[model samples]
Target chain A: MSNDKEWKRKLLRDMVVIRTFEETADKLTLRGKVAGGMHNSSGQEAVAVGTMSALDPKDVIATTHRSHHHTLAKGMDPKLVMAELFAKATGCSKGRGASMHLADVDNGNFGGNGIVGAGVGIAMGAAMGIKQLGHKKVSVGFVGDGGMNTGRTWEAINMAVVNKLPFICLVDNNQYAVETFIDRVTGGRDIAKRGAGFGLPSFTIDGQDVLKVNRYVKEARDRALAGEGPTLINALTYRYYGHNVGEKGQYRTQEEIADWRDNRDPIDRFSAQLISEGLLSQDEYVALHAEVTAQINAAVEFAEQSPYPDLSTIYEDVDSGLLGAKS
Target chain B: MSTQTETTRNTLPSYSEAFQQGVREEMYRNESIFILGTDLIERGGHFAQVRGIAQEFGLERVKDSPISEAAMVASGIGAGMYGCHPIIDLNFIDFSLGAMDEIINQAAKIRFMFGKPVPLVIRATSGVALGGAHHCNSLEVLFAHTPGLSVAVPSRAYDVKGLIKTALRAPDPVIFLMHKKLSGVRGEVGDENVLIPFGSAHTVQSGKDAAIITYGYTVVTAQKAAAKLAESGVSIEIIDLRTLYPLDEDAINETVKKFGRVVVADEAPLYGSITGDIASTATEENFKYLKGPIVRVGGIRAPISAHPQSAEAAIPTVESMINAVKKVLAY
Candidate 1:
């Protein structure tokens, strides 16, 4: 196989892995295996995979509550994330943080925040530190349409621009924030324009197209590393599930959901493009799906077998330095 | 005689000046230490607590943030997570409400949630004397209620200098409450660098009749009241609790047992106040030693009015402390 084929195959495999993981998470959540609430990123695979593919190993990312795809894309072990959802001691954060707070700092993924737009300032601060330390690295904050309406997001953008920090505000414009549509809540349809108002170079891209997202994110990363301040990329996509697992999603019509599922599926589009371009074969696609399914199944088995954290460790890790010590 | 000699050797600086000196020393020692807030760069902050810091540490280290308190505090948490020490100035304590989500949710819980240490220090000017509702508030009780945050309300210049240094170096997030009315008050701060650890209380004056537990500018008021009561042979022990969260329970218990009477004073609202917490703790722990009911002198349960008399009536004053002390003595 050629290098181009290998790259395409890898991207396809990552998207498959994300889809499989999120699908499994949705099932587990319904089965009452995963506590709290699970925010599944079933249809927004390309946004996570494409943007993460553009980042270097040292570059950092701060994700949102709906961040399973981002975690898998940033190279976190599937088993560890599954174990975290299982509330096992071996999970990331030592089972202290569940799905909404999954973080793997070793892989430069700062973790997902529960609050909307909360990660914006954190990513900007990390970018400011990177700039001050003279490191050629950028930080990306993945926010939802709900996060865009928050004042914290604009404040962070203004600060990033003023400080000329290396940062990217990736607004995953999935149309709806919970039940309310973006058009109903937001002042306008264009989320990227908010960044431009802060003097940032902003653009809008089709989130379903992996190639376009990868290209635009790579360009944004380049601009950031060159000390050109921050860029905002509003990736328009759709969610396959409700705001969280277990909800019937009574807000939208069945026809709209079916339309996105049939016509705008990121995986189906990417696979069709690959097969048409002769970069992938039908046999390879079937094998890739099998591989991802097996990988997800093994992760689920591992999480099911893992033990819960010890009750004695409840007070641990409250403060990084003073763990188990008095406040 | 020894206390007088120590005071003679120490430098006399106002609370604001002591804060400036402490920040300057820490910034000089730690390259990663930076201060950011509104009007901090050119104006040296609203109270001038960070005056001349930008000139000394360069504008890159001392930054002036926009009027965005939420970002200012959240950025501190982020910077601290990345191994940089950040000192964020909330222009007024009342403005902290604008950044409550950042302070109550993010800064206070991120370290615990992610299992990473965040050494972020927030300096907020608090009190109800000089300003109305918008500018004046003593919200240390709110911070003390938070699990991961350490709250310090230093009353004296000496304690402010030491506490600020200690807070900057602490492994946990800290909220340093500076009293607005005490900013111009001068006190003797030792020349040698010192760090006052959190959760410790100092006995401003030792007496046998009753214990007046207080913090922040109220400590000053308690001291004045204690002196006046001493003239009337009504002795009172004043315990200045510099830190609120890891409250010096040992010191409080000891004083409570010694005096057998208690009066808790604070500038916050009377209901659900830090003084109430202290009174509850003292009563629950040392109920046998109590010679009278634990009295509380705190802010009235209302918004601080702009009128001078109403403002004076809003918060606890030296007169109120004396009245509480006298009432407790009568018990």
Candidate 2:
């Protein structure tokens, strides 16, 4: 919309890479190559890509179990992320944290948390530090609809609001948390409206649209950096697959899933919009998809060839002083 | 406790004041160090362990938090992850149960799980002083059982100052347990700037007939027992394990080898207590040196009561330590 062709292309490219990375991760998880459960970020690509694109590289992010897309969008190396998923020594966490706990603090990605709404407090703490250090950086915490209901999330939001920390509590309301629908569990079913209880700029937005997500996040970032306090955003989106890779998804209807996947797919909608706006060509989109697919495949190869951590190093990194530095 | 050599003019400060002195010194030394806890700013902490710190370092660093222990702890973990050394003050150690998930799952494991240093300290006032079940809890074993957390239980003013300074500078999360009863207890404090390394044992009293290994408030009880036992010609050695996680196995072994009889005591309940760890280490590491079955003196397996007599009977007393020492010396 702003006539920034290169920037639009880059956004599209980042989303494509996330989608490819998630899809490949799903395949690997399905094939039993990756250990443990993997929460795919396939349908929620716009949330991670759009939100990350709105912030500076120095800004930090704390995400949830469904964190592959966020990790890639946050500028983590695909090979390192893939190797982490593969539980290899070459992984970002050195094979310690698999799918659920992927973190690279040096890259400003505080890492993916397994506990619901846990990262919100972490992000709040980072914001507290940022404010104390007088840094103009923002910290974003990504949670699901279920994580929104967590008591600590509200507690953290209240503290952030009171302290006016540069924080953003971004909720990806994918309509379902595991097998339960959000409405079935959440009372009143309005996550954003509750933000007024703490007196902050809070709203719900169309998460499937990249531009809207980016714009909202950009405004939130601006408010945070300006010392206007925290923002709570509930972005409504959907998941294309089950909660985990191997679930039957009996909790959701096939028609509903099909409708979201076919009609409301974020990447497809954004690509179409980009093409119509002359920001991207159909031929270029196809080439970009192929390029990202090849990159993801190469990452898989690197993960496959990566070595598992040695048994002798089981106790390593438990104490920082024991290991002079990270191996 | 004659441990660190006298290098500067010694001052007699209460346990709580020494803790504040340690925190104040560290806050001045490190700009990244900040404190988050309940009643820290207005009430100056329930135990006054952080008294005058808010005025010294400003409210931004020594900030008060709501009653949300979980969020407070998680925030500290997050801040520590971001290169800020946060001292999360849980007013009472019993209240730490509210944030077990954050403490065990997040703070304790994040460093190991993420392969990054979390320079954070969880400061809590521990031990029973007729505070009842809700207030009296010695969770040293619970934290000591968990890996990646350095547990420091300082009984004296000197150890409180030095150990806390070390905890503030630790590259990992440290559970700094201060005794509630010892808050007003006065003791000799060492140099203001020196730090006491964790895992080192302080020899409270030198003896040869028997050894009583203890920490926290139990150290005082052990000292009383040693005084009584010394009159009976059973010279008992007292070893104060300043930090429990790095359990000072070498010191325990040395004491075991020298005395050939041992009694491990702790204020926590005997079931799943750090006393078991100390007793096991004594037998396991110094089996040949031991002359008798290692006796353990700890709190009774029951909820600590508010009644003064019942509370006194709940945790290890001077009489209990005397019995434990005598039981081991029978060999």
Candidate 3:
């Protein structure tokens, strides 16, 4: 484990990089450079960063559609991720998968599934595979508040508990699923308690605090690796943007968004904590922000310059052709 | 002669037993292979297709999942993504509707999207057999329509054993559809490493007269119809397409050109059915060689009845195939 100063700096760097990348992606989408609409994790950075920080390089993770932060935090190359969003040939999925389907399997980031709550089973299976292979790696599945309503989530949770799979179910409760507030649709508002109902150790944490998120996730990971089965962590966060990029977000008032951004912004809270502890100076924070901005701008340039996949390559990778169907 | 007949009789097994034997053989060959589904470990599945597998492979390998088809399939996909080969037993084909997203979107598209091979097999029981709309369905067309999926509909014990083994070893995902009514149907299955490849069709009977093409349990009906038509001096040819998606277009073309008249039969609903796909392919490719329009014998466009008689009447019967053959010959 890193010291307090190193941890604060690393957390701050990850959060800023996520924020910068998302902001750049938003601009790119608006300008028609990015084909698919973007789902920015603007206010929900701390959850992804903290949870990912607790994971080892060998541990696998599966994310939801709003997955840029998770993908970046899981250590996927920013250049390749940006290229994928641009539909370039040099992308991670060879330009086949767009924003919602970013995956770096070699790096242990299984995928960013477009379907809600679908990753729960995938992560559970990965954990099962690890156990079968006699490895101690734990798999983490990230789902949104809306994903909890899906039947597959409960099924996966039950299976993980019964089988003693080393898995972690992270619920990012941003309080909404697309347009509707979660409470309006969900039978109950307490997302973390639902995990306990499935007979697993679970917790609800303040998602705006990166340190708290990191500590709780580390505990879960340790318990999982120690053969205690799965853990469900509900990170209470908020999305600053609408469900997608361009909407005005009329479902919730501007005041609510403003209150969250001002009083509960994860980046702001983390920055303040670092400054209060004398870990990061104001000058150092500004320089780090500038550095992340420059790095994101370079990634945008790389994506813009990257060539689109040739039309002839369209039929490639449909199947591995190991069984002799078209390659 | 009596001793030889007894030896031949001992070699034959029911469709379900052949399928179980195939799974057992593959599990023995590949240590990574495992089975999981709703009543697999406890009761050996609703159709008893996996009836003594849990005892042989142990409960750890033959897992009994919850009534969660989506998670079951998704977990299979995840396991397949890694180095494990999973054979997911979806009890009834109709129940696959609950897990279509995982089947069609995830399992079918994962390999294509990620450029990684997911070697998995989905064994689903299909066809109407004294069951209602929810229990009985031949929904292989839905899977065949998807690009990345390979579909296999085996009729006899011999074909099911070979096809199921092949599916387990295939590089991509395979949907193995077994007819529910044909579980008791017995056929001679040789004790050999018989692995049938997909995209190949079996010419059950050859003739110069009109041809009848079909798959699944309907192949049995088609063959029976051909035998009846033969009694009437009509030498109707029978072609059983084992796989649906990578259809043996060459076989369809060869039979259509030789016979000049054709009848396509399937157990699925008429609209957007596999039979329609076969008919369309035959007409499009063998239009110039056609002496008559291609006809389709399939299930009616209504909910399957729960009653036995009506349920049997819902899908194509031997009489329907025979009538279709005669109608095509007349045309």
DockQ of each: 0.52, 0.48, 0.55
Chain A only: give the TM-score of model 1.
0.97
Error of 3 at A111 (Å): 1.2
Would you list the rank order by DockQ, best first? Answer: 3, 1, 2
Model 3: CAPRI class: medium
Q: Give me the displacement of residue B106 in model 3, in angstroms.
A: 0.9
Worst 10 residues of 3 chain A by lDDT: A318-327
Residues A213-269, candidate 1, lDDT per residue (tens digit)? 999999999998888889999999999899989787678999999999899999999
Off by over 4 Å in 3: A1-4, A324-327, B1-7, B190-192
Model 2's lDDT to the true fold? 0.87
Q: Write candidate 3's Cα lDDT for A122-166 as tens digits.
A: 888778777766687899989999999998889889888988889
Judging by lDDT against the true structure, name the best candidate: 2
Q: Give per-residue CA lDDT, model 1, range B1-331, as digits (tens).
A: 6998768645478899999988888888888888889898778888789888898879879888888888888778777777688998988878889889888888888766677777889888887775678877778889989988888888989999988888777767888889888888888775536777788898998888888999988888888898889899988888999889778899999988888778999888899998888889889999999988799999988888888888988888778899998888887
Q: Please, what is the TM-score per model?
A: 0.96, 0.96, 0.96
Model 2 ranges with Cα > 4 A deviation? A1-3, A322-327, B1-11
Candidate with maximal DockQ: 3
TM-score of chain B of 3: 0.95
